[model samples]
Target: MTQPPPPPPPNQPPPGYGYPQGGPNPYAQQPPYGSPAYGYPQQPQPAYPPPGPPQPPTPKGKLNAQAVIIVSAVAAIALIIGGGVWYSSTKDGRADAKSGDKNSTAGTTGGTGDSGGTGGGSGADKAPANTASKVLFQLPQPAIGADGNSATVDGSWLTDTVYAKSGFAEIVGYDPVKGTKLWTVPLPGPVCEASRHTTADHRTAIVYEPAMPTKDKPSHGCSQVAAIDLDAGKELWTRTVKSGDQAITLNNVTVSANTVAVGSTNGGAAFDISGKVLWAPKPTDTCYDAGYGGGEKLVAVRKCGAYGSRQLKIQTIDPVSGKVLSEYAMAKGIESASIVSTNPLVVAADVNYSAGDGSGISDFFSIDNKTGQLRTKISAPGDKYAAKCEGITKIEYCTKVVVGNDRLYLPTESHDGTGEYSKTNEIVAFDLATGKLDGQRADAGDGYTISPLTMDDGNVIAYKSPPYDKGGQVVSIDGGSFAQTKLMENPATKAVREVEFDMQPESAELIYADGRLYMSQVFADKPSTPGASDYLAIAYGTS
Candidate 1:
């Protein structure tokens, strides 16, 4: 099937942040169809001995863990579901059209190097003809122990053969098509952090506690770092670093340039893919590496200064040597920043907590990684956009947005649909180099809200959450025309929608590929009612 030619892209009058001249616009051609792409664990373990001596209080300028969770969760959920203004768009897009970083038309995919896929991932999960999907399986949530604390299951992955998910104290591999269990990799304790990146060869990194928490020792610090062979279903190696007298707690872990980097209050450390330490942490009082962003590039968010007067330095680093290649210091008053994309060097910051709506972002900085210079800063008010970031500790964690084709695509906050009491939203883009609206909007239609999953070739894979009683959908949005091609439509049965809606996109881990959609949770609480069904994950596919 051929795609229709799209009108020329509308330009945001050239007076804004450096919208370079002579750039060959991607909207110049029509694209053909059929392309684009696009966790936590279970169980309670027996109580072990004391984890360690008392730890120090959270450093100044850092939000307490409980405070961050409460502020972000409650406010984000309200903003996402309630009506709000949307950032206006200038025109439509043609997904099949090629994209590049050059001000010239010769480049392919999206950027100069980070194009169709990053984070060591492959193609999008799209099938042009498969529109209807059925529930394939559901993994039941693990029961909470008597202590009432939920288990943290932080990762999930999809390969051609297996769908791996983190469980109470292990990683389980399942058959992609039949939902059959394949293997389980047990851990010493619950997972605290998981890298979303998967190497082309199916290996990933994670951080866990050194031991399970018992009644007398329910506070095992998060200190263990390890790599897992998803294909082999085994722990390849386990490693850790120590502070003055105890294991340092790791806040985040990521993979890039053949190195696994982990960072937190103790600064940052890197290891070769096979388990050898590349560099150890060098934490200091004035500064510390909070976390890292990884993929085609490795970037670090360096926090410096004392409490009440903190600052952030975004550094594009050499993953193997732990060397800072380039650095961009965020403006004063912005104590935290979230990495949006590593290659393009996009970082989101709330700018002194002005976003108020709990988005953890008020502006997005687009930088020139080669020179460490800020190219632009796109203003993304919380009320107008729906991408949410838990920016305190997990620096690379942001939801409902995709960066590709030199653009940042995010959904508008859900607003009134055409019908009374109905709500809807659209996906819009901003030129990363110009900090201006791209002028194209992809409507989520009535009674639905769309979120970008990833880039496919030059197109985009998006999930449209359904209305109260309708089925959801997965679509390929033409990068040029803004036209949507349905790839999968999930069933709307009360039974299915109940599970789908429970796994909100902000916190849920999603894996969509080859006509299948896997939605899983990062944490599961004990069911309130006896014998009630609570799922860790629920999957659907169109075959």
Candidate 2:
């Protein structure tokens, strides 16, 4: 009765329906009322209307568009992760390969390998231990005459004056190796007195003074220069020059490849190799020392004024052309002088005197040969410790300053006067370029002194005075570090009346020829048989 059941729920179909009921029945037209529709199977109506809009009747056996998109996104994410892992692994592998290659190369090249190679062997490794071999030449005696004058050891030849039966003098040479006589050359005359025998470039130069004549005859009063052959013991040539009424002495006679230069009491002169006078006798106030510098230059010291006067002159002349290259007027009161031969420069020292006491004051000057200008002047210590060229009486006074291999070596003697001969030797080395001391000064000893100090290939070889002996000790010193070692020792004699006795060594020289150290000694001896001056040869080992 309620209005006919609300019009049958507004004309609603049953639980499930497809299109309009009167619309010719959409499935009826398609499958004859669902009797075996499409594949021949009868189907019941769905309990509820098939989802909304029937889902557009999906095609049979085909994937949906949404499902295809979801599967594709998942596959892309997996591929990205896999690619990242593979790239990281490949890069690490390449780095390892490069490291292995570097290690192999370093091992083959001998590098101090801290990475990628074995670190065992290198040039920094220490060397094996082995004893270094050395040779030593010893001479028992090496001086001549009671006064020890005119004694020298040049190389393998020892030259000195020996007393003859007729009260004459003779110059002799002895083989140092065998202790046998090499040769004997008689003096020019019975009265002729020998002074010094020096060698340069394997040749010997003999210097002497003629004997003075008595009331029976007038004295010649001349000095002679003779170049002698060392091997043959014969005089090559002789030249006699007048020496005023007084005795004229020679100093530093040097023979080089093309010239012979000698310093005399009055002046200096240069001669050719064949004895032709290059520069004739030139008058100088006081030409006491001279030497040949490198090239064609001659360095000489001249006393400009009278004795006790202050002014002295240092002259550098051209040996080949006799031209004055440079002249330097040293301090006013110069008493002594010394010249050192170094490249591009020349060093000279002047010993000055005080006003009242005449005490010694040394002034050192460095001159540049290229510019002819004074480079620097250094004032030495006071008189008590100053270095002076107190004549050639002591070789230390003459050869105290030595120049070699671009370095300058200066030896100073102690002034306390407490040791043997009242001398203590000390050596100092300086760099020539910078004019600075290279290392700490070396103290040779208190009593032992060195004379004729020289450098050979950066090694300093000097004749040292031993304690309680007048003989000499050969010492080798390192130039770089001032380290010293005594190479050999020569002892002096005790007997005072012996005629032919071994004397102390006054001078020494170190000659490195054919890998041997050849040393010659000139000893003052009075032989029991009364012959000429006794000379000896001493040869030792060198490396």
lDDT of 2 by residue, 429-535 (tens): 66655666677566656545554344455666554544443334455566667677665443344321011112222222233222223333222223334554333
Where does candidate 2 stray beyond 4 Å?
1-168, 189-201, 212-222, 242-252, 282-297, 308-311, 342-350, 354-361, 382-397, 414-425, 432-436, 445-452, 463-475, 485-543
Best by TM-score: 1
For residues 462-525, what per-residue lDDT tens digits would candidate 1 score against the true structure? 8887766667787888889888889898897777877776676544677666777788877666
TM-score of 1: 0.78
User: Using lDDT as the measure, which candidate wins?
Assistant: 1
Lowest lDDT 10-residue stretch of candidate 1: 73-82
TM-score of 2: 0.53
How many clashing pairs does model 1 include?
Answer: 25
Task: Provide the overall lDDT of each model, using Cα atoms, as 2-decimal numbers.
Answer: 0.65, 0.36
